[model samples]
Target: MKATTMKTLTVSLTPHQAAMMQGAVESGGYASNSEIVRDALRLWEQREEIRQMELARLKRAYDEGMASGEGREVSADTLLKELKAEARSSG
Candidate 1:
């Protein structure tokens, strides 16, 4: 496959970060500094997406529990038994 065309971009970073990026580029695994930045940005974007999905799942569960109108009862034994059952099933 043909390699992609390169473009110039300017960014600011701390000295340590710059050193790390320069080291990565000098390792010869990345074609340029831009390649390293692009890879990191892609990974960050993917992780952000996963975080958003998890947040949405938690929100849905909370809303469902609220809608169920279950009275709040904090019996420690009951909670422990239910938690153990769930852990057993999951693990």
Candidate 2:
């Protein structure tokens, strides 16, 4: 992927967060705090992408149910009995 534009900005962190990033760099696990931050941003981006996908799935399911025409009325007990019978047959 083409490199995105970079910006330099100062950020404040709690002592523990600052120490964790510093320790990573000192241990040679990361080149610098900026590298650690960038890696973290990538993970945040992926998590957001997955979150959006789940929301889309839910929306689609809702639309499908809405478009399924009139619903039939069934008692909870009757529905549960049928569901149990279906599960047993499938199993």
Candidate 3:
């Protein structure tokens, strides 16, 4: 097993937040406030990673759409009629 170095930092929290952390420890759900903070940080990191992936996927889609070429304007009635005709033929 690899040995990990730990660093300590002071953090200030609101009264409600402090009570919530303390309650979590008292409830036996967490061993200490630091553990709760570490767990919360892990969740936050996961969420950030997912958000980044979604942004990249959207960017790729936008690039593909732009590469497909310019779009033409079509009238709604004409488009609808054409769609209905195609559907009828396919069906």
Q: What are the lDDT scores of the predictions, listed in order? A: 0.91, 0.97, 0.97
lDDT of 3 at 63: 99
lDDT of 1 by residue, 2-82 (tens): 998877878999999989888988988788888889999999999999999999999999999899997787799999999
- Report the lDDT tens digits of candidate 3 across residue range 54-83: 999999999999999998899999999999
Q: Cα miss at 43, model 1 (Å)?
A: 0.8
Relative to the true structure, candidate 1 reaches a TM of 0.73
Using TM-score, give the best candidate's number: 2
lDDT of 3 at 13: 98
**Model 3 weakest lDDT span, ten residues long:** 4-13
| Residue-level lDDT tens digits of model 2 in 1-91 | 8999989989999999999999999999999999999999999999999999999999999999999999999999999999999999999
lDDT score for residue 77 of model 2 = 100
**Which 10-residue span in candidate 2 carries the lowest summed lDDT?**
1-10
Provide TM-scores for the models: 0.73, 0.82, 0.79
Q: State the local distance difference test value for candidate 3.
A: 0.97
